[model samples]
Structures are given as structure tokens and as C-alpha cells.
Target: MVTLRSHTREKARRSTWAFLPPEIRRMILEEISRQRRWSCASTVCKEWHAIVATKNLNRLELNGASAEGLSKIILQRHLVRQIYLNIELPAYTCPQCRGFASSSEHGKLAKDALRKLSKALAAWEPTHHITLELNAYSPNDTDHCFKNHLYGFKHENDGDLLEKQEAWDDQRHGWVKGKQVRLPTTGAIQQLFSTVISGVQGERPQKVPAVKGVVIRRQMRRKIDRLALPKLLKQFPNLESINYEPWRVLFHQPDLLDSSCERCDQMLQDGLPKWPKHVRSVTIFEDFNEQIMEAIRSGIDPTISSTSMQIENGRRTRYGLGEAFAVKSRHLEHLSVSFMIDARDFFTSCKTLSDWPRLRSLVLTTPLMTKGPQHRMSDFLVKAGQVAQKMQRLKSLVIWHCSHDEASAVIFLKNKRSRRNVHGSATLTWRGTRDFDFSEEVVETWQQVVCTCNSHRGYVGQCDSHQLLCRIERVEGEIISHGDAIHHLRLPDGVIDPTSLRQIRQEGILQREARAVEAEPVDGSGEDP
Candidate 1:
């Protein structure tokens, strides 16, 4: 009896251990963190809660509730390495009055919240890296009012803000006044250099540590005043990466450049031979202006040579490839241009492509369908093929919203053939859309094309297989009966021998055996043979 009792206790303990080991449990908890409903795991037990609160959590998603909950979470000062916060700015209202706050009040609330968050972040972890994404929807009256209020508040409180505002004020007065303004002189630039050097030499904590990157997106409104940028750039000396879409007005007025060019000319004549090279990457989202293009064409000082340049809204204008990129070829490593150009004009004007030996990435976004009969998409493809053949160092190329008919594909294939023979390695990604029925021949041809293209020494690969598989999978579900679906398909005889598949069959056998064992009579009756 004592032996039987000990055996029963051992069996119960072994059964309890069957669920999962500690390492397995931790992995399951970590996997749950990737999903949006991670909080559901929190309710499972204390063991789960402790696992979920670890510092190195890879995926952090903040929904509406979590945005408000962040204040509490930050207080713990947990080692949160990465955080992604998605906040939907609620309709602003005063908590005290419980009434809809004025637009100004709403703006004040936003600014105060950001300032408080910044302070908390600074205190919690000075070295903590963060990527803040502010996703605001289409602006309404409230948004406009809020922005105005924020502007007013910054103008009043922040002295640094006043500098940019003063620059704008100077631009408004045409830069001619008894204003006694303090412009960014040579002495100030020298002082900035000294400050950076001192910080480096002393090995002291930097006042404003350099950010990894910053992205600012705003809807189209007024034109961005070019006069305002120099001062803003000066403030963030440690800035390495910046992406911004300033308002459109900056592009509409050509006169802004006329004045700027005159100013630069005067400065150059006075022996001020160099421009500041603070920014390494730049993206300008506006129509190309001829005057500004002329300034760049005159020759960019080697000191300020930019590595990346992305120009959008390059529509029908005199500022084509010849006028825009011909001169700055040596400096640009990545270039993206969107516009319509005649095939002949593009080939002839963009002949200096050899200068950009370091260029590795190129993107050309052009119209797919031609409205008039004069210009055809085929002609565009031929020209694009010629350009690709010339760019020997090109690794990644994207042609957005463009048709890739047989002729276009042939042109690309020709480039691929040449690249294989010469460079021994080159990869290109082609994306397109077409309306065609799915057939065995089509599938075979696509597979052949993919295999042949990828067999080359430098052929990285293509995405046709994965895309076609997805389409076929979708169609399979639509055509097949529920019972005959691919998920329920039995393996072929040769694919897996019955003997190997038989192991899982034992589970059914055991279940039947259990039923038979349970059904045995109380008198211990023998099985009915």
C-alpha cells in the first residue's frame, strides 16, 4: 500500500511536468509579444507577466490605450530598447472644464505633452534611442487652429525658434533693412567647429547627442521659405540624417533663387569660397525650379557634395536631366528622378552618366499610359533600357507604375545579358501589372524566365514565384470543395511511405483502446470475441 501511494504521487508529478519546460514557456511568451493582443498573455499568470516585462522586447506596439499608459510604464525605467507608439490624437477637450477646448488650448496640450515626454525620456535613459511617428490625419479647422497656437507658443517661449522667425521676417522685408540682424557669420561657424572639437577631445557628454535620423512629414500648404533652412540646420549640428517635405510654395516662386544666387555670387566674389557641408542626405519634394537648378549646375563645392538626392514632381519643364543632373554627377551616389522626357532627349542629355561611377541605386517613375498618339510607352522602355545598360554600378532599380510588356522585358533582358558577361554580378527588381488568364503554359514560361534569369553569375533573383504562388493559392481555395481543399490533401504514395505516416495513426488506435477499456464491465468481464 505504501509503494502504491508513492507510485501514484510520482505519476501525478510527472503529468504536471508534461505541459512545458521553462525555456519553452519563455519562448511562447516572447512569440506572443509580436501579436497585437499581447495583453491577453498578461492575464494568463504572474510567470507570463514577468516574461513580458523584459527590457529587450523586440516588438513594442502602442495602441490608443497604451499611448495613455506610456506615462506609467516610463516611471519603471525598464530597459525598453525599442518602442513603437501609434497614437490617434483624440479630439481635444479640457479635463477641468469638461468642454471642447479652443484650438489654442488643444495645441498647448500637445506641446506640453511632447515636452513632458521628452523630459521623462531624457531622465529615464539618456542613451535610449527612439523613433517617434506622429500620424495625424487630414487636417480640419481644429488642426489649423492647433498649429497656429503651437507656432505662437514657440515664438513666445523658445529663443532658438525666434532666430528662424527673424530670418523669415528678414526675407519678408527683402533682406534690406536697418534691422541690425545677427546673420550666421564666419566667426559663428568657427565657434560651432570649436564646440564640436572640444566635446570630442574632452570625452564629455554631448549636450544634444546626435540623432540616428529624423523624418518630418506635413501636408501641402504654403511654400517653404529657403531663407529659414540655414538657421535651422545650424541648431542641429550633430544631425546625420533628415527627411522633410516642406510646403509647395517654395517651388512656385522662382524669384527666391534669383535673390539667393545673387547673394551666393556676392559672397563668392568677396573670397567666401566654400558652402557649409552639414547635410549628407537630402530629399526635396517639389517641382524643380530652373533658377535653383542653375545654382547647382554652376558647380557644387566638393566640400558640400551630397551622397543622396531624390527629386519628386519633376514634370514637364525646361529643367530636364541635362540641366538638372549633368553637372552634379560626381557627387551623387543615389539618385531618383520622376518626370517625362522624350526618348531621344533623355539619351542625348544624360550622356555624362559615366561621371557617377559611385552611383549604386536609381529610380525612374514615369507615366504608364500615354494620352496623345505621339508618345508611346514602348519608346520609353527602349530609352530606359539604354540608361540601365550605361549605369554599370547599378544594384537596385525601381520603375514605378510603368508597364512591362514583352518589348520592355526584352530590353531589360538584354541589359541583364550584358551585365552578366561584363560585371559577373548585377541584380534588378522589376514590378508591373497586367491582365491575363492563368494557364499552364503561362506558368511554365514564367518559371523558365525566372530560372534562366537567375542562373546568371550576378543574378540575385526575382519575386515572380512567390507572387504567382499566392495567386494560385487564392484560386485553389475558390475552386475546390471544402473537403477536397489543398490543406486536406493526402500525401502521394512515393512522397512519404505509409510506414512513416503510421506513427500518427497510433493516436487513433490508442483512443479506440481507451474507449474499449472504459466500457469493460464492473465484474471484470472478458472481451467479447
Candidate 2:
């Protein structure tokens, strides 16, 4: 009887659900969608199914080996909007190569997969905003970063999280989590991380991502390069954008130039490739430097925000990414090719940021360095500020530090066009340029350590506490006082906040006066009169 009553209640509630206000019903549906329970929520009633029908993209699944079926959808061009590709290419291994991975089964499989996709795309137009999310890897018997993160059991009970559901599938011979596959060990699976592009000398520039239980070889990277993925990607003139996560990437400059192709050779000489004219955005970020992370964890005195972007003949050959983006296209708006170019060649390559009128957002991440800072933050900001001055339509400009756990400089540009904002006065414009945030403890530490130089020479070193300000301000150990060091970070006068400047100046004046009083020798007269 209790079960019957419960069923009766549920049936009555379903009818009453429609009686609720339209806005309330819509809000409920939106909440469900946000939680990614769309499939379950949409089936509740006819009204919901109608609302969600368009949002759901039932992507056509196709294997890379048999992508010929994709060409048949040419008549129904609208159906080409979304696609999920499953690729399983024939492995080509050469034992004589002797542990060299480019000829390994993994590299061959990745190449074959891309070749198949290229053939299929020959029939399709490049105008669509299509993105291919590649889940390319096979089951291998080893404790790798990919496997551990995918299937590791959760030990942290304090945090609220959803348990991952996985099961053993015998047919696929792997651990399956929905469509994601993780097979148990063997040499059957080839390693893509070991692969590198042509002309990329030395080790495959790769670092393990920051995750629990990640096992990376402690020894330095070995020199064995040659993966055709980079060169092949550049050949796709139809490719409008590159979407990749840097932390998980293997190479800093994966778009390596191939010497074999005559067309590529010609483009290299021409200073620009045959990139799509309609390309709007190109963003690429670099993985964190391990040294930077170690420094921060060890509480190093200096803030290692700066890095040397040293190139091994790192000169801007036609292969430099900044040169690739130096096209004179009106359709280009947002451009970001980080870690692809260093500060040395980047500015010279794209010396025409002012020319791109429609560009609204710009993000850059320079190459990583093993040595000390290449240039001061002040000089870096000066170059960035010059770029900002000419950009009329630019709204957001970001420059990431080439290190982990270090603050990056960000500038927020705001334009107020309305006269009403100023009580029917002249049109007003607002701009804000600020550096990274500092913790209260860090600020307190700096504030406590006033420069102890009597003659106004840089002498923060005399203080009992080791001040980190000089390192951050980076005025070459010549820090006169707290304010002088801070003042080194100069933005355009128009963008700098007047209140902040005044506060800093006031503090400087007070520090100088106190420092002067402390240094005065005793009169010994004992006469106040």
C-alpha cells in the first residue's frame, strides 16, 4: 500500500509540474542542465524535450580507418557540424631502430590516423566552427601519468566529489569509463610522449603534468626526434584554430617546419604560410617549469617570475610562430601563440599589433628558461604598454609568467562611451592596469623591512629580515627604499591609478623621515632647552 501511495504521489506531482510558472520551470531545467544531467532531465516531459532538443548535439561517430562514410554526408552539409572520430591504425614497428620511438607503433598509428582524417576533410568546407577533441592513446602495461589519473582510487574523504564509474571490458580488453578506455599493460600500446617533430633537436621537450602519483623518468630527456604531426597540422590550410592544454602537451613548438615539402619551403622563405584567411583566434600555453615550483615550495627569497627564453639557434627562422601570425588579415581578432615564440623574436616578428584593428584579446606566454631572468619586468611592461597604446579595439591583454606558482601581469581595458556616465559631460574612458595579487603576510613582511641606508643608497640588505622586495622589484640590488622599488613597475600614466600612486608616495616620504630620525647620532648634551 505504501509503494502504491508513493507511485500515486509521483504521478500527481508530474501533472502539477506544468502548473508552475514558466520562469520557475525554465529555472529548474537550467539548473539540471548546468549539472550535466541533461539526458535525464529532458525526458521528464514534452515541454522540456522541446526546450533541450537544439542544445543537444548528437555527433556522428566514425572510425579514422573507415572515414569514407563521412564523405557521403556531403549532400546534407548541416549534419557535418559535429563528429566523434575513433581511430585504430596499423602499428609499424622496427626493432632494428633500437628503442628509437619515431618508427615505433605509436607514432605510425598517430600519423596514419591524421592521414585518414585529412583524406576525409578534402570534401568538406573550412567555414564551420568545428573542433576535433582527440582522445588518442592505447592500453599499455605501465604505471603512466594517463593511467594513474584515469583509474586511481580516491583516498581523500574530506572533499566532496563524484566517484568515477569504470568497468572491465573483455572485448576492448581495457578498463572502460563510458567511452574512455584504459587497457592493462604491455608493449602493445605505443608512447606518444616519446615522439617529437622534425628539426626539434635534443630531447622531446616534455614534463609530467602536476598530478598525484605521476611517474616520470628522473633522468634528462634523450635526443630522439621525428614525429610528422606538427608539419602535417600546418599543411591543413583549412585549420582555423588550435585548442590545446599546455600542461599536458609534449612539445613547446610542435608546429615544426618540414624540409621535405616544397610548398612548406616556399612558405618559409615567404615569411608566411598558407593559413586560413578567416582565422580569428590562436591560443597556446606552455607547461610549468619544475624549478619554479620547487623554488616557491622551498620559500626562496626571490620571486622567480622572470625566465630566459633561450633558443638553441632559437632565432626566428620562418618556423617561429609569431612570424606565422604576422599576416595582414582583417578577419583576425584574437591571437595568442604562447611558448611558440620567445620575447627575443616575438616583438620583432609581430611589430604590427596596432595594424590589427579588430583584435580584442591578446595573451602571450614566452619560452621557458633554465637560467636567471633575461629582461626586467619594467622593460617587458614597456614593450607591452607600447603595444597597448596603438590598439584601439583591444580590451584584454595578458602576459603569463613562464613559471608555475608565480603571478602573471594582467591589464583590464575599459572604455566608457556614454556621456550620461559623466552627467552629460564629455565622453569618459576608464582604464586599469594592475600586476598580480600579493598575500597579506607577504605585504606585511615587505612593509616591516624599511631600507636602512642613511645616504639614500640601496641598503635593504642591512635590515635583520631578508626582504624579497628587491628580488621582485628587480632593480639590480639597488633598492633605495620600499617606494622606489615598487615605482619600477610603471604603466602608462593614463592607465595608472592616481590614488595608488599617491598612497605609495606618502608611504615613501614617511619611511625616509623615520629612517633619517633613526640614524641621527645622540647629542650627549642632555639639554632639551
Candidate 3:
């Protein structure tokens, strides 16, 4: 009686593929890495498994695999170029609480799993990329941030107003609705990756394990105990890039030095740098405070409007993100920052863009842009122009402003042309998306602007001095009325009133009729008499 495993193995041994050379077998397995359909191929026999294990796999997704199993795989294989640790947890009865559990517990569980994973990674050679996607739980269902107010539970006797208040409370704290939760300490995260680096260093003191990039797909709602960034970067001395989701602001406390303050202090001291100069790219995420949120909703201060490109203290001093980051990584080439409330200050602080000589591409985005006052957009354009003035290497500038104004939106385009005409020619592009409900006249003007630029057909020199390429698109839901390119402008229909167009057309016809009467020759009989 032959079992299935045995039967498969015997058949694989007798197959024509079994006679292929070792190099050909390795090549076939390598192709499997590209296709990502290795399950069927690996089941052929032990020989096929041996071949698949050794080739360099660019990316390995451990969906629900155990750390021990992953460790075994790492031990058998060479370096895995990238690793995605995908873990999913659902709401369930908590054995500890003996009731419904929340997402905080799941977060803690993820930390523990990563601790084990870090230890496993330290035992093997360093990997280039590691992405943590542990927070893939349903955003609508997770109740980690929710809280219950006193008398908040709906009463059978409570009126509609009270019920509505209770619902608002529920919605506010819904992400964390349960009992008090404890977030993972910075030390735990540091030890996880540092353990691997230290362990490998102790065994082979001569070799350096350079992990180039680290990405965090999960949002960090709580502040770590210490500066996890500095500690982690010290381990991977050659780290080049880091992409992580946003965390809440690290508030200033009398006893605690926030990461920003600490970095600034470190920079002032001229001590050993926290991160390597080799770092080239960083994507930073900023938090939202009540003041900034209000400004975003209502408007920004008018006093700072005059000093758009220059540095101005606006309402409050901006966070020292750009200053501190430049202090640590002087050689950075690419930087993208997403701000919740710090958009204004971040722009102000970037006036020192010349300090980072290597910087080439900068991307700035804020949810506030969609609702910001006109002054805020004006200030942003000024700051962007200042940055452009200082940075000779800057070639790309992308702004995601959700506003409706032709003059403010194309400020960069105007600035770029000015610089090109004066300075040596540079390949400069000012690109972004604007959400506007355009009036018929505005749309006509924008179309003319685009057509005027296109008619020149010159790369740069022959084109009208002030004219540059432009695109305007009308978007209805997911469908687009324009071409399918990233630069398409999205305008929904109802944003512009049709009645306004009719009034303007009627006025134009009246003006034309009066002009014709004035231009017409007087009737021969009545004019001279």
C-alpha cells in the first residue's frame, strides 16, 4: 500500500525533470519565486524542496506561519530580500478578562509575536526589508479607542437627545471602548531587532548585517516608552529608508524629553549621530491637535499671509520635525511628510532646505489643505517657492491641495518657469491634485491655459515664457471624464450651479448688443442732421 506522499515522491523520482542538471533545477525554482505559485512545485519531491529553499527569494510573506517554522526556513535559505509579517487577530472572549476582548490585547499579542520573530531573525543573517502589517483588523469593528461615559449606556427611559449623546460617545471612543489598556514599551521593540544584531555581532564580530529599510504598515496610536527610532537605527547602522504610519504627538512632560527635544539636544551637543548619514529617504507622519484641527476646519491666521515664502511664527511654533530630521540625516535625497495639524509650521521650518544639499524630491500633503483658508494655501506656496530657491538639485515638487483657485494652485508652475528663465535650465515639475467645483467660466479659462501651452510645442525655450502644461479633469464618482493619469483634476458635477452660467451668458449678450449699436454707422439721413 503506497501512501500519497510516497507515491508522489516515487513518481517525481521517475519523472524527466529528475534527470535535469542542478543549475537547471535551481533556475526552475528561481522562476517559481517570480510566479509565486510554488505550492504545487514544492510538493513534487524532497529534491524539489531542497532546490526551492536555497534560491534568493525577493519577498517572503509569512501569512500565519509560526516563528519557529520561519526560523527553520531562514536557517535553510540564504538571505531573504524582504519579509512581510502579516498577522490578523479578531475580537473574541478574553481568557484573562473573561469577557469580550478589544484590539489593544491584539496589539499586545502582536508585540509578543514580534519579540519571538526578532529573536529568530537575530539567529540568522540580516534581511534588507521588514514590513509589519499586524493591524489589518477591520477598522469599523475594532473598539480599542472607545470608552464608556457615566450614565452613557442607553437607558430604556432616556429621550432621543440622550440617546444621540450616548451614540456620539460610543463613536468617539469606539476604537478603545473597553477597560484601560497598556501599550508596548519602546524597549520591547528595540530588544526585538537589537537582539538579532547583537547576537550576530557576538558570533561573527567582523561581519556587519545591514538592514536597509523598515516599514510599519500599522498605525502607532500610543507613544513608546523611549525613542525606539534612535535605538533601532543604532542596530542597523546602514539603514537607508524608513516608511511608517503616523503616531500621536509625544507631549512634553517635565520628567520626560520627547523624541523631538532629544534629537534637537543631541544635534546641539555635536555628539555621535543617532542615525547613519547613509540614510537617503524618510516618510514622516505628524499628529493632529485641537488647535490645528480647528484651523483646518475654520481658517488660519491672516498675519502670516504676507510672509508666505519667508519664515513666520504663525499662530504657534511649528513642530521641529524637519529641523531635527535634517540634523540626523544630512544626506537625505527624498522626503515625504503627511501632516494632520502641523502643515503650516512644517513649511515654515523647511526654509532651511539648503542645508540638505542632496535632497531632490519633496512631497507635502495635509488633510487640512482641502478645508484650509485661502491664506494657508498662499503661505504654503510661498514656503514652497523659498525651498525651490535654495535647492538647486530639487527637480520634483508634489503638493496635494484640495482647494479651488487657479492663481494659488499654479503658483509653483509660475515659480518654476521664472527660475528656469533666469538660472540654468533645470528639469522642474510642479505636480499635484486639486478638488474644485469649477464654474463654467473657470473651466473655460483653465482649458484655454492648457491649450495655449500645448500650441507652443516646444520643450521649454520656445514655449510662451509664462505658459506651462496644464490638465483639468471632471470626475463623477469613480468614473472619469478625463484620461486615466495621476495628474487628472477631479471635479464632481453639482459643485457648480448651472443657473450661474445662464446669468453670465445673458449679461455677455447684452454687453455685445450695446457694443454693436455704438460701432454701427449712423443712418445717412439722420446722423449728420
Candidate 4:
């Protein structure tokens, strides 16, 4: 009983309360949470260990030394909640710091250990949310200098061991091939080669539990192979979004499907599967091949033809959409497309806006210059005016990264023409550099036209009765400029217009007052601006 009491006293001493107040302790814990490294907190005293474990702070990056360490943390439910596993391959470290050289036994052991860690994480559950970043290059393989050092044991017919070693070197062309000749048929070299080939082929579907999304950086070279893409897609049934780099879609001339439309039709029928109807959204970077394009064009459903399409600098082909391509998607609420398309082609593609009855918003981000100057500002404006007349349900129009001054001019002209018609009123939002201030010039020109029309004997602001025609507002950041005369404009209700002159003098007065107040130096300071 006395001995038990003594042991209990020692335990109590070890569990003594931390010195800092509760508030200070909380502040420290929060600070620790913000740190990138969790090992520092883990190394602290027993109380700190408990606190860190309880707080569950730190995004667990399972790579290098920490890969094996993850097994322990994952078992602790509280710690697992704090961690977001980032599974990356091991980096190659030199023998000096890594305490393992390629030639040494310890080096081999370390490599095996890291490989085991990778295998373990690959088998972990709830894999979907884990950010599995597969890098093509390992960190330690930095300069390609280490390739010279890897060695493999060899055998020779020569009686001398040194002679055998020399023979092996000659066969390998200097650097050792890390394989043992005496090993059984199913040796490490065969296994390694097979593993590498399988990895490249992506034949092994990584069991990612509950994966909501996946990002593949490298182009799946074998995607066209048997059951690759279909199998991969099956893994992510609940995938909401997939963001791929532009290079994934390789644009190759459709050699198999000649230039003939019938040939294109046959190839698509023979090669590609029907579209996955469940996939609501798909973003492709490369210009679609003729076969794919034909499949899209000739698809049975009108809705499929009307589905929102985005292209980048693709050559003009008679996509079977005919008039349907020009029609807005009744189902497609958002659409973004960019490329060098002819004005006539654009209008031809999307001529009937009435078909897209539910098309509420549209985004057109195309390069400004396309071919010659014949299809200039005036031509585009005339065509846009015709199209805008049909968008009866459009509520917002956003144009981003435009190249030519003509595009904005066309939009303004279209808006002006539409406003004159019975059904043309929508908020136009333009985001681009003010390289061409044609909107201001257009507004001024329109104002002059309105002024001249109203100047006639009986007309009293009758011709300038429209709200959009009367107000021309240009907003850049916080500052807004209207017609050439008004440097700034302020609205009475704090809502400025993009197309009229409304109380311009009040904006001037506000600016002048602000400048005057700013000019008066504060206290003993020098003159202010």
C-alpha cells in the first residue's frame, strides 16, 4: 500500500498543470495551429502533446519522413480530423544528410521504407478528399548527377573477381545496372519494370475512397487505350468538378476520318462512346477533333445541339448545328467561348436567340483581331444588333479580355439599337483595359444625335426619352467618367448608369471639394495634394 501511494505521488507530479493562464494557453495553442510544422508542438511537454492532439491542428503532408508517421496519426480519430493528407512520392536524398548513399545498405533500406509508406497510404480509407499530388519527378533526383552512382552486382566467366566486375562495367557502358544476375527469374528488376509499366499504363485503379474530385496534371498518355478513361471515371462517381491543364487534350489531324463529313460520321460511330448524360459539365482545352465535333453536331437530341459550346482558336468547320448552334441553350444558363471566329460565322452559329428562351447570361471572351480588316467595327456592330434583338430574356452580358476597339463599339451599337426596340434592356458589364475609350465616344456621338433630334421645333426631350440613351456611364475602378465634357459623374441614388448623363455637375463639385480638403496640409506637414 505504501509503495502504491509513492507511485501515485510521482504520477501526480508528472501531471501537474501548465504554468500559463487559460487565456494565454489558448492564444499559444492558436499560434501553434497557424504554424506549418506540427512536429514542433508534438515535441513539447506532455500537457502540450495532449493539447495539440485535442486541438487536431495541422494539415498532415504525408511525404518523405512523415509518410510512415501518418499511420499513427490516422489511428487517432481526433488527430485525423485535423489532418488533410497530401500524398507525394519520396524525394531522393544523398547519403550525407539522408544518412544513406545509393551504394550503401542503409540507402537501400531507406528507399524500401519510403516505398512501403507510399503503399500504405495508397491503401488508406476515405481517400477522396486527400490531395494526392503525383509528381513525375522525385525531389532528390534534382540534377541527374545521381544517375551515375547506382550500382548492381554482376557475374563473369573470368576466374578473377576483378575481371568479372570489369566485364560487367563494359556491358553496362560504365554505370552499374542495379540488378543481380544470379537472382531467380522473378527478381527485383522484373518486378520493378512491371510496376513502372503498370503505373504508366494506369491499369491499377488507385482505391481512393470517397473521392469527390480529382486533378490530373500529366496527360494520361494511355487514356485512349482499353478501358482507361471509362474505368477512371467509374472511380469518381460523385466527382463534382475536374480542372485539367490545357495540354491534356492533344490536337492531332484526324487522319482516320478524312476531311469528308461522311468519313467523320463513320469514325465517331466506330470509335467514341455515347456522351455520359450524367456529366452536367465538361471543360476541354484542346480544339475537338473532327470526329468528336461531328458527334456533337449530329447527335440525335436538339438539346444536345443546343448545349453550350466553348472553343479556342478552332478552324471553322460546318458543325451540323446549322441554325441550332446559333440558338441559345434553353438549359444552359452559363456559357463562355473564346477563339478567332468570323463575325458572319458567329452570327450564323448563334442567329436564333429566341430558341434559347432560358438563356439569362452570356459571356463572350474572343480575341479582337480575326483575319483581315474587312470584318471591322461597323460590320460586327450591324451583326450584333441583329442578334441582340432576339435575346428577349438576357439579364446580364459580360465581355472579358477583348482585343479590338471594334468589339466594345459593336456592343454599344447593339445595345443602342436594342434599346430602341420594345424588348432590349439588360445590365452590360465590361471588364478589360481602357485601351480604346470608344464607349465614351459612342455615348458622345449618340448624345449629339439625341440633341440634334430633340432640337427640332416641337420636340421637348422626346427623342432622348429612353433611360439607357440618356445616360452613358464609364466606370474604371472607383472613378467613373461619362461624356467627354464630364470628368466624373455621381448619381443621386448612388447607382450610376453605363449610358447617360445624369447630374454631372454634382460629381465635379464633390471632386473639387475633396481636392480642396486634401490640399490643406495637416497640422505642421508640408502642402498636400
Report RMSD (Å) for each prediction in the order shown.
24.3, 18.6, 18.4, 21.4
Worst lDDT window (10 residues) for model 4? 520-529
Quote the positional error of residue 404 for candidate 1 in Å.
17
Candidate 3 segments whose C-alpha is farther than 4 A from its true place: 1-40, 43-58, 61-65, 68-71, 74-76, 86-112, 123-210, 219-226, 247-276, 285-317, 325-330, 340-343, 366-368, 371-379, 402-529
For residues 1-529, could you state the per-residue lDDT of candidate 1 as single tens digits? 9999999998888777345788887787778765554666665577876766552343344433445444466534444544443323333222211222233333334334433433333333434444343222212312211111111111234453324323332322122222222222222111111110000111122222223233333322212223323333333344433444332211222332312322322322232112123333333222222222222232334454343221122233222432343333234444433232223344456665654465555433333421212134445444554555455554444443221111011111213443235422222222222322234433333333324445446543444432222131111122111112111222112111132223213222322222212221110001110
TM-score of 4: 0.37
Model 4 vs truth, CA RMSD: 21.4
TM-score of each: 0.39, 0.47, 0.47, 0.37
| Per-residue lDDT of model 3, residues 1-529, tens digit only | 4698899887788786757888887787778845544656655678766656444344565533465455576344454666665544443321312222343445455555555555556555545344332223322222322111111122412553323333432323221222122222222221111111111112211222435676653232333323344544544555677664433332222232332423433332332255556668766533222211221222324454343212111212224544554444346687665432234445566665545577666655443444555455445555555545455455455554332222112312223445447532222222234443323333233233323454345332223443333333333222111111112332112111233222222322322232212222211011100
Residue 259, candidate 2: alpha-carbon lDDT: 14
Best by lDDT: 3
lDDT of 4 at 390: 56
lDDT of each: 0.32, 0.36, 0.39, 0.33
Estimate, for each residue in 421-485, the C-alpha lDDT of model 4 and write its tens digit.
Answer: 65332222222223332344334333332234543464433242442332224434332211212
Over the stretch 1-529, how does candidate 2's per-residue lDDT look in tens digits?
9999999988898789777889998887766655544756567677876555334433444565665665565544443345545444233333311122443454455445545655665656645434553434333321221222221122322232223222222224333432223222212222323432233223332211110011111111111122333443444544555443222111222233221222332343343344334446554432222211221223322444432211121212233444555453234566654444444345555565446677766655433221223344434444544545455566555444222112223333333345444222111111112232333433332222222232145332333232223212222322222223224433223221243334334433432332212332211011111
Better of 1 and 3 by TM-score: 3
Model 3 weakest 10-residue run by lDDT: 520-529
Q: Worst lDDT window (10 residues) for model 1? A: 191-200
Candidate 2 runs further than 4 Å off: 1-55, 58-104, 111-128, 145-190, 194-239, 244-272, 288-331, 349-354, 366-375, 410-412, 416-529
